[model samples]
Target: MAQQRDTAEADRTLKAKHRAIWASGDYPSVAAEIIPGLGALLVEACGVKAGDRVLDVAAGTGNAAIPAALAGADVVACDLTPELLEAGRLMADRSGVDLRWREADAEALPFADADFDTVLSCVGVMFAPHHQAAADELVRVCRPGGTIGLLSWTPEGFLGQLLTALKPYAPPPPPGARPAPLWGDPDHVRALLGDRVTDVSAERRTVLVDRFETPEGFRDYFKERYGPVLAVYRAHAEDPERLAALDRDLAELARRHDRAAGSGPTVMEWEYLLLTAHRTDTSP
Candidate 1:
């Protein structure tokens, strides 16, 4: 009993740390530039329809939620960061779409069971420290026959490789924390979802990164706006040489993955896994 309580306390501390890290940066700027493509994919893949009650869990700045609302669905956008939720509210207002924005954790969503027709997360929920609890909340809020759409970075993908490159400079993750890239694995996802969902499937897709004139330019942009990247930079502020080495390594990774050969701006392809599943009916 004491062990369980200790574990729970540890999880809460880790989650608090995650929330602070994410809120430290201006993620909306980065999300604005990248989330549209993934949002469109989720809309189509989930077969979102008018009047569908949609929940965008771990929604960052209303990327998928705002688009889902524009599609005529009733949307609720939930995120742990209040700053990001405010950004999402502004974005929805500018786009002439109404969305219910809530500050909530993915692992313990405040919504009731079987409440949504569709649940979507674009490169979001994978970062949750407690993957199983996050998965359970996702399934719990989705109605039977409802669709759940998720986009995650594969271990072999650009974003995954970037994480690997940054690891040498970053602090180790908390004990018992699952790596985010595991969400990209079909088998792992299936195991996570278990028998709670049916018709589970995964597809590999490529999303093009914004073109950059040089690898350094790409690195600079992420450092300025991406939470995790910015956190790493801040952590190494006292060690200039270590930070420089980290930057160089990141730039090298970007250069190697550049899809545009000798161009004014180089395009980079980021591979991601698209997962879709239907919540199983519990009624006898």
Candidate 2:
């Protein structure tokens, strides 16, 4: 009972945060920084073809789902937050692509055996409290001879430094935070797949980071477009003192990260791994 209650509370809190952050238009641009590279790579790795059924896990705002659908694959996009799904639906419509948007949990997928020809997730599985369970769920829905493709961020270089700079204002994240969505250590993915797959491999790619156009852009984007950070501000209900402090802290951080507007685009180096594995039945 206690565990269920805690989970419920956390879900509510995270949902509220996610909704608020995505409500603003600033987030999509911020997300565009990293989404395209990951999305493209996953699509290529999945080898989606016309008429093939594809499952996009944690499909935030249809970044990957939109492109895959454009390629003529039948696509199902699933995510935990309704707000994010709404955004994705809007994007899909704008792109003139038909994508089935479903609200579902990654750890417990609502699909049947061999339901999809390919399973793809862009920074999705890592959110599962039980990585193995979620991974198993991913493998479960894929056809016996299908492909499983996952995209995860590797925390290193400019990416690590940038995230470190922004960490103070965000929610008190769990300790030792690696990258999110696909947050687990690399070994965990290999262990989970076991003998279920073959031709398994992982690689890195650079994502173009474009959230802040200027120092002021950074301040506004973080304050208005970041969910967990705004959650912290929401927590200060009726407390003017804390609000001022948070504002001051964010201001300082913005100044530190801010560079001249025409100083050329600042790119955050994100090492993302595209893991590809084929079901055992399909392999020679």
Candidate 3:
């Protein structure tokens, strides 16, 4: 009991900072460019169909939710940051897709138990401070036999490498916080989901990131709009040396992955894991 209380308290403290960091940037601009196809893929992979009640947890700018809605599902887009939720609302309106939007935390979802036919998160819930709590909430909200789909950056992927490169300059997570990349590991995911779900499957998928003239330009573009990258810059506002070192590291990583350095804009493939599982029947 004491450990649970401590963990909950720690999560509360960290969540405030996380909400602020995510809200600090205009993530919609970046999300708009990368999320559509990924969202569509998740929608199809999860078997979301017309009349299904779909919940896109930690949905940034309504990526998955919008597509699900367009497919005739009743979609609700939820996120911790109100700014992102608002961006989702605007984007939904522009897309002529009607969906509900809610500002809610992934670790403690505001919905009732067994409330959704399909629950999805795309590179979103992995950022939750408490992985187990978030995972439990995702399972709890999904109806029996419903589908849960997720996308996460693998530990050996480009995004994972970027996170490792930025670790030195960024603030450490709470003492017991699980590493987010664990979600990308199929075995780890199976352990996390445990017996509560069945038919667990995972696959690797690649999404192409926008091409930039140079690695430095690519780094700069992300720093301006990617929430986590913006947070790192903000954390090092008074330390130019650390910030410069971080920027150099990011640029180097970009250069290392850039295949067409001298030919044309640098297009790179970001590999992520697509996970799908069905909630087990709890009725007895």
Candidate 4:
């Protein structure tokens, strides 16, 4: 019992850390400027339609939720950080779409079992510290015949490599926490959803981002705006030498992946995995 209590406390601490990390930088800006279209992509892939009761888990600023709601679905967008949800709520209001914003943990959602006809995440949920727990919650809240959709950064993608680059400076992941990039792996996700979902389909896709004109620009933008990257910089704030090295490595990673004409703006295609499946039908 003592050991279990310790574990539970550790879990709470880690969850708190995650909430802080996401709330640290200006992520809503990143979502709006860099990866906005991916939300629409996930919504289309999930086949979300009118009147569907949809839940968007780890939905930062309602990226997918807003689109789903605009499609006429009844949407509830949940995230660990209330700050982000509030930002999303405001955006939904501006878009003239009715959306419910809830602060929720992907690993332990508050809704009743099988409450949603459609459940999805766009570049969300993958950040859950506990992989299996999150996957279980995803399957549990979705009706047996309901759809489950996910869009995540692939391990081979630019964002995945960026995460790897930042790991040297970032805090060690909590015990038993899996890397977020694995959600982009088809085989890995298949195993996670095993026997609980059916008719699974996975697609490898890319989104072209031209937000920055140079490698240094990309690195600098992330330094200022991206939460995970900024958190690492904060971790090494007193260590100027290490921070310089991290900056160098990040800029180099961007340069290596950049594809652009010598004269025009920098262009990079960030790879992602789009996976959709239906909850296993268990009706008698």
* Per-model TM-score versus the true fold: 0.95, 0.75, 0.94, 0.98
Q: In order, what lDDT does every prediction score?
A: 0.87, 0.68, 0.87, 0.92
Q: Model 4, poorest ten-residue lDDT window?
A: 257-266
Put the candidates in lDDT order, highest first.
Answer: 4, 1, 3, 2
Question: Whose TM-score is greatest here?
Answer: 4
Clashing pairs in 2: none
Off by over 4 Å in 3: 1-9
Better of 1 and 2 by lDDT: 1
TM-score of model number 3 = 0.94
Per-residue lDDT over 243-280 for candidate 2, one digit per residue giving the tens place of the 0 to 100 score:
77777666565455444334854333345667888877
Which is the leading candidate under lDDT? 4
Question: What is the model-wide C-alpha lDDT for candidate 3?
Answer: 0.87
Model 4 steric clash pairs: none
lDDT, candidate 1, 102-172, per-residue tens = 99999999999999999999889999977898999999999989998998998889998888787887788
Residue range 116-225, candidate 3, lDDT tens digits = 99999988898886778888999999999999999888888888888888888877766768878888888888887789999988998888876578889889988988
- What is the lDDT, from 0 to 100, of the residue 126 in candidate 3? 85
Error of 4 at 218 (Å): 0.6
Candidate 2 TM-score to native: 0.75
Clashes of each: 0, 0, 0, 0
lDDT, candidate 1, at 197: 86
